[model samples]
Target: MNSNRPGVLILSHCGFSFLEDLKEQLQRRQLRCFVLTSLPLAEHVPARLEQIQVWADRLYTADSHQLKLEDVNNALQTLHKSGEQVTCCISVWEGYRHLMAAANAALGTYDIDAQQALALRNKLNVRNQLADAGLSQARAHALTAPVLQTLQAQSARYFIKPIHGIASYAAFPLREDTTWKALETLRLASVEDTVYASAFNDGLQFMAEDYIAGQEFSFETLLIDGQAHVVAIHEKYEVTETADTVLEDSCTTPPASLDQAQIAAGLQWLEKVLTCMALRWGCYHIEARFTGQHWDLIEINPRVGGSLISHSVEAVTHGHSMLSLWLDLLLASQDDHAPRDALAQQLNAFQWQADGISAQSVATFFRVYFAQPGTLSSVALNELPLAPTVKHILLKAGDVIPAHAREVFLGQLLWAFDRSRQAEELERLAHLSATALDIRYEPGTP
Candidate 1:
């Protein structure tokens, strides 16, 4: 990093080694980092901001949390007034992109303006961008009940999601009239004063889009200086009721076997969306569904995916880290990660084995399956000894989680394989993971 360049400001929440891993990467490139604190919610107190600063190698102490737009302005004003030069503000927080983007604007940290930030945070604005760009996507609209009723009557399947939710929270899949009515109740419940309300209410609107059928996969990459650089693509096994109380016992990411042609098509679809969005620099996540050879846009987040998704994939697939690549791009971009790569459509998202259960059933199922293999995979439980493939096995006896494959499916069992035997080996481990962690919707269900 050039000594004259301003310190990099990382907007972080959810304490973990992500920051530390990033710090190590930056150190290798000699870039200095500063952690600026922001509240994730009413309770998103920046507890370890100072600790982050120490790990970051530079320090900026703005200890208060931002809730309203005014709060964001105040924080930005403070940063802008401070003599230090600001380089960039990266939103690595799980569900707090709006807050992160707002603070970035207040300080004039990047070129994006307040209006543009609103456009990114609001679902309604994104809908217009797709329409204006003439991008191929499911029909989407910010709706009134009458309009929703009419569309629901025509469409075979539809998706209902909050304009500004994190973790795919409150995402509803409308397949039947019953499901559609359940969504109506859910929509009204958002207006309720109860805790069961939809997370996005204030400026957040709900989006109903024609449900695009096919396998679902995710792509996470950094958009440095506007271009979308591919980072890690995850073969999504499931998208279930974990976030949406609207349904239950439904969600999974299946195996993603691919041909070079389909993979290229997917990448092209992503490239087109980014070009039209007028996005300049940041982390972005795109979800698209494929039917036969055609692909329909599901959604695109102008930030990183939640649940440490990119990081976990990298951990299991290759020795290289996705977050590490993102930090490198943010500070000192690699010259050759350019678009004209010799490699044809990269094999990014591939599910090797049985789909994962939600995070809820991870603990107990892992114990029994590892103890006895037939329950999960055909292999005998006693055949193999524990090895490095097990990253963090959350399955333990007596944990309170049930086996129902709802929101928190079998706890995430992520593992990596050596290239020479990567494909076959990882599949076996995934099968073992599923076997060890059985599913039970009700308590003691599995």
Candidate 2:
């Protein structure tokens, strides 16, 4: 590896807090980071200036919301002019995965299925791809006016959501009988309603897909040359489901409920789907549901798992960084000596062991959501027998809580618990939600 060559180029769109941790970790390994972010430099730049100054060797900003190919190329050329080289580029955000792939392809360091990148963002397209590959069991229909009208008059149950979405936002289960009523009730919003900033102008398109009934799990994986390596399996916990919406409450690693056979089956399905999609290199956070007899694909994202899953992975695995592994993959893509063989050899070295993660430790992350819309008066957590590792409070006492049709959380808590205390912790947390965690609100017009 050339000393003057750049170590990694990070394409960041939003200021996710975890990116700071990732950058620091990568830099600790003597890897220099260059950042190309599409976020407006005026408004969002000041907040992250400390991080940018500390971790980045060079920083490039795009004037617009979308990262243009020309802009990336220009930045690469500028780096070359300054006697710097970008060996690998990476992003953990879903919206920027395509951009990262495009940049990688342009650099000729590694190849990603660009078409698959586009297809992965749209849920309907993913469903179609899965069905075509004989990798999915569910049927999905686009939510056109006619289709909604027909579904309104039928006896089918389905789930409907934006074609491109994150954090289960705007996703709801639809019943055939109440489909028309639900449509009338659903507030029509555009791309502007999205939580993260994006360049997608494709106004909200919804898909009505068969809602598979079973236990849901996420397979955190790394793909090298389209080969899927399972890092960890996560058990998804949902806030008590209402008729219309489902929101995530917690995610635990090691999927305690899944048997070894079921875990093997889930990995097999993951590999097949990754191969079918031709995702050559990157991190994947794939969600799936398993019935007793069959498995259904929920969604497959060509990025690292969101929320605190990455943190939980490290906590459970005793400091093994999944993001570091992904960065190494990118760096290996630019190797002069045995590129493919180097990647393969590195993959083997970091291969995820079935027993690598400790069984005695269980890592869990919980999302805190407010039920009432008003000015938040106060929030207090109940004392637990075991203290949490990380506590991120996203809202303060005086923050205004806007009314949302679907449940939106205020903050989150990350905990690494002893296996023996898992059940007790869950129960205590639930009880605390009802009694100890006081979320007082000053009523206002919603």
Which prediction has the highest TM-score against the true structure?
A: 2
**Residue 298 CA displacement from its true place in model 1, Å:** 1.3
Q: Residue 314 deviation, candidate 1, in Å?
A: 3.9
> Which RMSD does model 2 reach against the true structure?
3.9
How do all models score by TM-score?
0.66, 0.84
Q: Candidate 2's residue-wise lDDT over 202-236, tens digit each? A: 55557888778888888777776666667667788
User: All candidates' lDDT scores?
Assistant: 0.49, 0.67
Q: For candidate 1, lDDT tens digit of each residue in 1-446? A: 22554555565443332566666656665666655444332322355654564566454433433234454455445555664455555555533456656655545544344455556656656766676676765667776667677776773676777766544545767544535455555555555412212235463356776666777766665665655556445555433333353221111222245455676676677777877877766666776667777766766776555444654545543443556545444434324444223111231232221122111111111111112111222222233443423333333443343221113323444444433454455456545544444432323234
The whole-model C-alpha lDDT of candidate 2 against the native structure comes to 0.67
Candidate 1 local Cα displacement, residue 136, angstroms: 2.3
